[model samples]
Target: MSRVRQILDMNAFDAATGGDGAVKRRLDNLGAASVLFYREPIEMVAARGAWMEARDGTRYLDFYNNVPSVGHSHPEVVAAISAQVARLNTNTRYLVEIVDDYLEALKAKLPVDLSNVVMTCSGSEANDLAIRVARAVSGRHGLIVTDTAYHGNTALVTEASPSALRRSPLPDHVVTVPAPGEAAYGGEDIAGGLRAAVVAAMQTLEARGHGIAAFLADSIFSSDGIFADPAGFLQPAVKTVQAAGGLYIADEVQPGFGRTGDAFWGYERHGLAPDIVTMGKPMGNGFPMAGMAARPEHLAMFCEDVGYFNTFGGNPVAAAAGRAVLRVIAAEGLQENARRVGAHLKAGLAQIAAGSDRVTAVRGAGLFLGVDLGAQDGSGAPDADYTVQVIDRMRDARVLIGAAGQFGATLKVRPPLCLSMAEAERFLEAFAGAVSD
Candidate 1:
């Protein structure tokens, strides 16, 4: 079996080698906790639309960052944030019109049953709150996740994120099942196979004296190599978890907000009404904001035991930024754009895969796609080193991308939603050259 790769180690800079003055200054400041992308990290200065400009004046088409989901430095979002902060920036304690307005607009997009929304500064805090709410409502302590899932970075969330752990084993309260993919479950029936894995995991958790509180998963399985296909394949596993007295926490940090194209939320594509939904990263078009939506009763139950508050979670500035994102997504018709452009991009990638043995597979929905790299010897083994080479090649060609999956051999292709056809074609050309070389 291939060695499991940590999420942070994928295409990361080697701090030991020590970089130039700028890199050295960054390392000195952030130390070992710093996670910089690429072997030679680029000092990004500015970004707009689908491209980022390095401090050295080279412009690279960004196909890796999902945080700026709509586009980089979107004018509307920037204006809203600036306008709101200039007027007033306050927390949830006070009655703010924009804050409630944003919440109401956001709630309309969510399942009606999830009536209460709690905002947070990041996805990590949102997930941590969701887990607590699930445990409170389900009256259980165990959790289940996919083998290479990366939920968040909080102390509690890190324990559940298998891909984030480099040396420590998964805590007993946490159990992992294989990711929902053809590799784990043959193409015959992915739904049934994933359901069985969840069942087995629940059994194991029960045996360990920790009844399953929640079955948490990134709806698209982004970190587990983006296994999004057959649309409703997740329903069976989700239903099994709910029937087993466990809540389903949909971690939409990566795949939410119309990135999947077909639906506003990734869970919607799977036909799921998740018990709790936690979202961030793309919530505010690069603004630091995240939120958890749950049934009012669930939030009430959790609140009875402990109080939850965030000083800057849903401040007016974040609300303005979020509202702008929602408005831009609708006004610009970004969802439809994602669907159309994503299809074009996927087809181009499929052609590349057909021509190259090193390109093993192409899968995912909408703008969130994953391309698996393999050994060139026809054995089709996952090749991390070759993947890094391709990443560097793409970088040299002025295209930015990153790696994911258990072996770090899958290129995570997630450009902004505003990516034009010309940009998609440009990426394909760069990708073709990267792989061919």
Candidate 2:
């Protein structure tokens, strides 16, 4: 079996080997914390719509950044941010109309029962808050996550994110189940198998005296290689957890904001009404903002013990940016666009996979798709090295992409929601050439 790969290590630029003066300067500044893409990182200057311009003036079609879900430098978002900042930019303590307006607009898209929304600076903070609320509401310390899940980078979230851990074993309060897919659960009954795994994980947690507080998962399983098929596969497991007195936290940082096409949120695709829904980055269209939605009672319970406050979580500027993102997504009909263009893109990739042994599996919904690359020797083993080569080749072809999954062989295809059919075809063409070469 291939050794499981760490999330940040996948296709990361190694500063040790060295680079140009700019790269050296960056390493000197950020040191070991610097996470650059590609062995030869591109210095980007500007980006608009689906394409980014390097400092050298080369344009690359972006297919890996979900943070710019609506698009890169969307005029409305930029305008809104500028306009709001020019007028006023204050924290949540001030009763900013834009903040409330944005919250109302956001809540309109969420479950009605999740009445209270607490804004945060990032998904890490949102997830951290969700975990605390879950523990408070359920009175349990244990958490369950997928084997290769990556919730966020905060110490609390990092403890639960197995993919983020390079050396440390999962703490006793955390337990993991295999990702919901054929490779983990077999083809017979994925939903049932996953439910059983969660049940067993809950049992283990209970045995450890840390009864399950939450079953936190990225609804589409993005880092677990983008598993979106068997549509309601998560229902059984989520129900089992809830029945066992555990909250279900839908980490929508990756799959929220109509990226999944069929629904506004990925949890909706699985017919789930999550107890806690955490969203980030894409909510503000690259603006630094994130939020957690929960039942008022649950949030109140958590707050009673310790108050929650963020300096600039739902500030006026962030609210304006978020409002603009929501407006743009609705006005431009990006969700439908995602559904249509994503289907076309997926079909093109599936066609390529059908004809090529190296392209193993294609999965996911909407613009968020994952294509596994395998060895060419007919062994069908996941080839991380070949995946890196394909990524580099795609870069050479002026297309930006990245890798995911436990083996780091799954091409994570998540272009902006505003991706056009022409752009999709361009990516397909680049990808075909890259894999073939």
User: What is the TM-score of each predicted model, taking all chains together?
Assistant: 0.99, 0.99
Alpha-carbon shift of residue 298 in model 2 (angstroms):
0.4
The whole-model C-alpha lDDT of candidate 2 against the native structure comes to 0.94
Which segments of model 1 are wrong by more than 4 Å? none
Q: lDDT (CA) for every model shown?
A: 0.95, 0.94
Model 2, position 225, has a per-residue lDDT of 91
Model 1 Cα lDDT, one tens digit per residue, 9-126: 9999989888778999999999998889999889999999999999999999999999999999999999999999999998899999999999999999999999899999999999
Cα error of candidate 2 at position 176, Å = 0.5
Candidate 1 residue-wise lDDT at 82:
95
Clashing pairs in 2: none
